[model samples]
Target: MSLNDIDNVVEAFVKGARVASKSGFDGVQLHAAHGYLIAQFISPKSNERTDGYSSRPENALRLLKRIVSAIRSVVSKDFVVGIKINCADYTDDHDRHALVLDHFRTIAAWGEVDFIEVSGGDYEKPDFLATQTRSPRQALFSHFSRTAMDAIESLKQESTLSAPLPLILLTGGLRTPELLHTALAARHAHLLGIGRTSILCPDLPRLLKEMEKETREVGTASSEAYWSSPFRPEPDLTFSPIIRNLVPTIPLVGAGIGTAWYVVTFRRLAAPPTSKGMSFEPDYNLGPLGAVFWMWIWVDTRPTSGMKVCRRRLSPIGIVTAAFHARWPKSPLCKTLMEYERQILGLKLEAGSLGLKETLAGREVYTHVGWLALVSGAGISASTTYIGIVRSGLPALIHERVTSTPADWNAFLTMVRDININDIREGAAELRAASQRERLMEERIQAMEVQCGIRAAPRDLYY
Candidate 1:
């Protein structure tokens, strides 16, 4: 769905909650946690708008208020409304802690929200902040680091000043019974939101209670192995047949086809027309089928296509080729061409591999079907620039496989290594050439001046 469509759905959901409350539902908790839409809007880095939705700190709050207000219009005043916010997104700038706290302050004043659940991080950077998948690998003491404990303490302190909402649910890294009890004793959190642990051990609360009676300490409840034992491997759930059947085929089809077209169109718009005044109009010539084919080809053979149109000069044939190529390379396009090569070659390129460096340096030759063109035309010079700014900036686009899978991480490291080496090589060559030219000119000027002095030392100063 388009962004506007998502916005409409969110607004409708808020309105629906109010309607449900009016119909006798108890309350509604706006699900803003785990780096969902609301969380994206709340993040300073994510919401870069300078307009109504982007300006003042209050602008950020506006979307949340609209949702709440829509709910309030339909629901009774007695209904309980609350927000679950991330205290610190692991991926967000560390400096954004202030903004996060400020956002919470705004929510607290709303009077509609009855509670706030302070979690941390988005899905992409989910270590302990949003998910518990990595908890087993962590050192026992690693969970209670000063930063983690301090952030929790700060959230607790902030909630105290929050209007009337007396409840704060802290979720993230709070696995051990000892940690939970300590937090409870210190009044850091009211509800212990056990996400991964609960998933692993469904009856953890009961088990903890039973263990509490048997022992005075908290750690006696369960070992890491015990918690990990009950963990069921999560299965990949495909879209339901109903959804597959009901959703319009156009969007899926459009995305499949139009991605490259959109990129080429956007790139053409970004820059001045070439010397010939030739312009790109993907829809006009390519049509939907052509656009889809180009989009697919661009995705498949991103390495070859991504670099070709870096300057955004699209000939009629280029457009046709883009359409043809997109469809030609059919598997779900990896963001990078190196990824495609790795997949096809079935060779793991580890960090610092010379071959990996060669492949990445050669990436400029592999033109990004659509997005990369748009990115490069819009001023992304290199793949790293695209990754750092565009990919990292958008939570949805930031591929999390790098952290979730060791192989992905290794691939990323290799790519980065190659990019860095290429940059250094180019820079060093330029600097050396420039230095040699400067030295040669200096020697020539010195020789000429010496010859002039030898020819004429008898010039009259006053004359």
Candidate 2:
């Protein structure tokens, strides 16, 4: 962001906080996680400015600091103010987990903040937030959160107490009672947060509290017992592990795919099961085929033909090729993806073909928050941007993947368009384009400034 816009951005935070504070909300958590504007300023890969905002580590935090101060000034001291931050950038060479912790330490120590929630990864590499696998590694970000909590704890002990020391909230794969209880018992997190599991089982909070009560009574119920309570959601049951493990061809990654899955889950949980034979839970209803198509639409990357576009800093080989020299289709990696989808999902696809209008027509309006819903295949073809490539782009890109046979491909694309699959694509396309347009205008301004000998480069007074 431009320096001139700093005050305006800070004003937005303060104003929003005041509104929330007056609206009877308990507190407001500054969303500094998952590649938001605050996350961008904190991330080294995105923040390249040479001004005071980016000159040093503390300077990089100037925007957040100003906003925090402004929010505190407007709201009463008792009104809680918190911040959620990513532990890592997850991009190559931009590994700044330690730096983020130190920055977090400084903020928590200043005592302006009430609580700190630690999350990691953004759309560029969102696996930190949502892993590709059903049973992903647990507490991937605990080390960072633990370190921050320890630092803040020391600061509280070293200094005189004003308010209680800030509590740490850790989110990421803390689904099971065992994981949640273990983390809290070990002081890895003062509060435990669950994500997809909560969507799968909305009563997770009550169940957990009840389970805690039960455990206190029995005193010997193991992790196995906690899951076997029957009220506990089998969150991992959502995906066909064999199929989900494939494609994106990488191990334990793919944020776009994960978001898409959660979106589908959120939609299912939002409504009752269909009266028809079709189950709201796609995984249970469609089986392996459903999972394959899930990956196919959300995470799968295809080979590019002819000329290449320079979207990223590295070679324009695309994500798949950048990892493997050959095309994803020909490569042995994720070989099971298409095979399973064609065999299994093909049946579901054919069923839709018969009653496409009746089945999917009303559901287009299902997702209230479009991106999180993965509505119209959002994040399906993301490259330059973290969010999916929008509804139209999904079909456009999928058209390339299914084009091995011209007749089959043309027929499929026709069916896709007929079903209004790209309903949300227009909005996604506009949002994705706005950033690129801004970048283009900035580049053009820089070139003109150089020609005019105004300076070696244009300054970030573009607020």
Tens-digit lDDT track for model 2 on 206-305?
7778877877777463646775444433434344566656645542344444555555555445444457554334343433345335434433233334
- How many clashes (backbone atoms < 3 Å, residues ≥3 apart in a chain or on different chains) does model 1 have? 20
Give the distance in Å from residue 72's predicted Cα in candidate 1 to where it truly belongs. Answer: 2.7
Off by over 4 Å in 2: 90-98, 132-137, 212-223, 227-254, 271-283, 286-463
**Model 1 RMSD, rounded to 1 decimal:** 31.8
Model 1: per-residue Cα lDDT over 1-463, one tens digit each: 4558657865666556745553467887887755677766666657776766663676777777778877776556678787776654532455565566666656655666776776554545543332233353133223222333444345446544544543566665566666666657765666666654554355566777765565554364444334333323322222357655764654334333333454444434433444575633223444544443443343222345433333232343555455544555563422354544433222211110111221233343222222344335544355442233222222222233232322464565553454455565665576567567645554343333332322222222111
lDDT of 1 at 27: 85
Best by TM-score: 2
Query: Where is model 2 poorest over a 10-residue stretch in terms of lDDT?
Result: 350-359
Alpha carbon lDDT at 151, candidate 2: 76
Instruction: After superposing candidate 1 on the true structure, give the runs of residues whose Cα lies further than 4 Å from its correct spot.
Output: 1-10, 19-25, 90-94, 128-163, 216-463
What is the RMSD of candidate 2? 23.9
